[model samples]
Target: MAKAITQIRRVDPTPEELQAQSITKIIGALAENGESIIKMLDIVSQLDQTGILDALDAILKKRVDVAEIMIQQMNQPTMHKIMKNGMNIFKFLGSLNPEQIRMLMDGVGHGIDKATARESDDKKTSLWSLGKAMKKPEVKESLTMMVSILEGMGESLQREKDHVH
Candidate 1:
């Protein structure tokens, strides 16, 4: 534990490293795995359209949609930064006793990661851009869906932060 702390103290990654080793990659890897499974099942779907339908699952079933993932990771980092400001940290630390700090950390710490938030925001950015890019029904539907999902996600995240405290 002590050694881990010393290592953490010694090496705060640069922005590039942080971005390079982010959860976007993990999500992408997961999406890629999903894509392979989808591809394996594509033969069946190609043979029958009725077998497969639904925007969310369909999109996620594809290989690493790098552009989409990139957008999400990009948006998330900004929010994490905003939340982790020195002043905010000090205030947060001050408000909590030792037990509260432990509890706050536990609440915030879960499976949640900086990349998740940024990537979600990235999806929103992608949707806005997507809406601008096309004049077709499918893209319009996708863009609209993305807008609703991303906006709802952002609101939920904000509310989680607000209410959790």
Candidate 2:
């Protein structure tokens, strides 16, 4: 009968072997991604030439200071008001119909152009001329829309007042 052995020995790789293995893997990866590595190097070279790399490095090194300064600036009352107003404007725009806004902007653009042309012609807008303009379909439609908007605004104000009381 053959003798039975119970001891199990594990041989760990030497430091040199591990280093060689890592180098081999890195070389394989570099060879496989040569095109990408070259493009990355080109971008790095351009950034360096423009001094952007140095600026980015400096910013990264002083990130805490940069963050604090930015925070301080944003914490100012004017900044707070600007941010609030911006958010309110965005919210209002989000609630509006895009097509209606587009049409309104187009009308405003045409009106400005017409007004400019009239000014260049040195023409005065008399009451009679205004009455003639009001007779136009476009003018009538615009007036109707304006009155509707004013009515809606008045109703909103009245509702807010009633709630306040």
Candidate 3:
């Protein structure tokens, strides 16, 4: 019976004992957080007392719950992590020996140059080449303007592509 009572006493925290333990923990925690908590409390008190809270309330009241797809798209941490991991893999690949990388590059590049050469050669023989080659003033002016716009668009596209990834 005394053993059961002792066990109960050992297991149970009395109100005073629990309170004392809680106060000790609080003191330890506060000691660790003393400076930061004081600053945070001061800042929060100022914000609440000095009408910043009112301004925040007004701002929130004005906001409609319109879900922005673009904002959500920008904040995709998973996609960021995936991209980061992929880039890390690429970097790990890049750190590999030059001979192996060169072999891989050579294997992948085998027909690529020929394919690109063929495509560019096809575009070289333009339909307008005959008309534009004649250099008629009207054709020349129109072609010049078209080429200028194409150049501008190409520059803009290249710039955008450069900035991306």
Return the top candidate by TM-score: 2
Ranking of all predicted structures according to lDDT, beginning with the best and ending with the worst: 2, 3, 1
Worst 10 residues of 1 by lDDT: 1-10
Q: Which numbered prediction scores highest in lDDT against the true structure? A: 2
Q: What's the lDDT for all of these models?
A: 0.71, 0.96, 0.79
**Mind giving the per-residue lDDT tens digits that candidate 2 earns over 31-149?**
99999999999999999999999999999999999999999999999999999999999999999999999999999999999888888997678999998999999999989999999
Q: After superposition, how far is residue 72 of candidate 1 from its true place, in Å?
A: 37
| Per-model TM-score versus the true fold | 0.21, 0.72, 0.31
Question: Tell me, what's the RMSD of every candidate?
Answer: 28.7, 3.1, 17.7
Count of steric clashes across candidates, in order: 8, 0, 0
Task: Give lDDT for model 1.
Answer: 0.71
lDDT of 1 by residue, 1-165 (tens): 344444434667899888888878988887879978778688667756754555546667763785678668868977669757967989967876898558646645652575477677745556766566688775576578669869988998999999999
Q: 2 or 3, which is superior by TM-score?
A: 2
